[model samples]
Target: MLDPLRLAVGTLTALPVSPPGRIDRRVAGRAMLLAPIAVVPLAVVAGVVLWAGHALGLPSLAVAGVAVGAVALGSRGLHLDGLADTADGLGASYDRERALDIMRRGDSGPTGVATLVLVLIVQCGAMAVAGPATGAAAVLAGRCVLSLCCARGVPSARPEGLGATVAGSVRIPLAVLVFLLAAGLSCLLPGLPWWRGPVAVAVAYAAAGLLLWRCTRRLGGITGDVLGACVETATAAALLALA
Candidate 1:
């Protein structure tokens, strides 16, 4: 468990967690179960950054930007990079091979740049208007979607990579449990309008479902990049629900 926890924290964030000498798919798979636990502190750090910016007499928009920067710094912008790559992959060509090649190029295309800009703008606007509670809920909701993307029977886009290692790592029951816990947490976010949490969570799930179907068909399976895109897309969906 410690190895997996370390893997989860280390792989997902810039946090220093000494990884094992050898990492196998099983370790990566089991780590997905504990991914949310690692995300707890990440979300708290972002929330505190937002709070601090507000306390320092910053405007809501500025505070939202700072909070976004804080989370990106903490996580080393890996998810954001994933979002960019996924968009580039999906947009470069409808053909799976060409799209995957573009993603592997690791350079942002017009579509990737445009998608990232839109996502960031939307996220910042939502956080500015909705405040910290909504941010917290969105974080929780975003982490929950990872469980769905990595659940049993989900195929990996690459034969050997993070996607292959973690995909199908989680059992159906555990995946369902984690996702439900996230949805319930969304419904219980403190200081939020009662309607905000449920609506956000529901919309997040719907958005994820759509992504899963589309990506599976187009990419032939989910990839690490797709999961990253899912986090951002679903986070925006959840936050927009609050808005």
Candidate 2:
């Protein structure tokens, strides 16, 4: 249990944590399932920043932007990098090998840059309208989608890196359970109508699933970058739905 927790935190955020003593599919599965829980520190930090921004009478959009930036910093911008790489992969030549090569590159291209800018804008705008509680919920929902990405039938696009370590490691039942629990809890988000929470979660998953399907078709399967793209996409969608 502790190893799973450590793996989740160590991978998902910049927060310091000891690496798990051993890592196999079982550990990776549990880590993906625990992603939301492990990211609680990051979420809490975002919540505090959002609260403080409002308390100081800052412009809601500006505050939301700061909060979003804070989360990116907390995660060491790994997800954002993933998002950019995924975008570049998708927009690159349709040849699977070529696209994968582009995604594996260290630099971002024009398409990746544009996609990142648009997604961040949407995230910040929606967060401004959704308020602090929903903002935090959106962030958690973002990570919760990772479990779904690792469900048993999913395959890794490549045989190495973080993707292969966790891809297809999660049991379908466990992944579905994590997703359902996240959706159910969304109904409890403060200041939101009961319907909005679940709807927001649903919207988030739908957006992520679309991306998952596209990536699977275009790139042969999921990669670490695809997982990151799903997180950011779901976060933006959830915030939009809540707003």
Candidate 3:
């Protein structure tokens, strides 16, 4: 069995994993199982940093902004790249295949840049308005929802993309269990209402479902970048709704 902790950390961080050991199919499958488990600490660290900055009379907004950006770097540009790629893909006026092709390219077009800027601006503003506790809850809940997509949704426009490697490998029940546990933890955080966590989770899932449906119609499946965009979009939406 793969070490759940290593799998979780490896998935969350951009660290290089030794080939064969890290890229083993079994390890990838197990990573899907462990990714949600990894999100909790990332959320906690973000929350604590923002909360501490607030309590210390630092500009909470600035502190939270920097903290969010800092954590994003640690994730090795995963979701942000997703955001950019998805934007380019969706914004393209070409056919679906051509759009997907555009996304596969490493270059970012105007749409991708705009989408990234917009998402960051909205997230930063929402976090500033909602304060640390609520922002943390929203972010954590959003990530849990994203992890569910990776665990459950069909991946990729092809049979061999990153999405396909892990698609449907995650047990549905395990995803639910992790989500519930994360929601409970979010509620336990000071100053956050229990209802807020569930509500945010619900919203995030609903939004993800809509995106999944749309993607399916357009590309016949979800790509890793699509999953990233879903999380980023859902997180921003949840935070904005709470704010």
- Top-lDDT structure, candidate number: 2
- Clashing residue pairs in all predictions, respectively, total 0, 0, 1
> How many clashes would you count in candidate 1?
0
Worst 10 residues of 1 by lDDT: 179-188
Off by over 4 Å in 1: none
The per-residue C-alpha lDDT of model 2 at residue 108 equals 99
Model 2 Cα lDDT, one tens digit per residue, 1-243? 999999999999999999999999999999999999998888887888889999899899999989999999999999999999999989988999999999998599999999999999999988887677888999999999999899888889999988899989999898889878988888888887888988988898999999999999998889999999999999999989988
Off by over 4 Å in 2: none
**What is the descending TM-score order?**
2, 1, 3
* True-structure RMSD for candidate 3: 2.7
Specify the poorest-scoring 10-residue window by lDDT in model 3. 16-25
- Per-residue lDDT for 160-214 in model 1, tens only? 7778888888888988888777766666777776666877887887898788778
Q: Write the per-residue lDDT of candidate 3 for residues 109-227, one digit (tens) a residue.
A: 99999999998888887777666667767766666665566565555665777767666666678777867786666566555566776666677777767876777678767777887
User: Which pairs clash in the backbone of model 2?
Assistant: none
For each candidate, what TM-score against the reference?
Answer: 0.93, 0.98, 0.85
Note the Cα lDDT for every prediction shown: 0.81, 0.91, 0.71
TM-score of 3: 0.85
Better of 2 and 3 by TM-score: 2
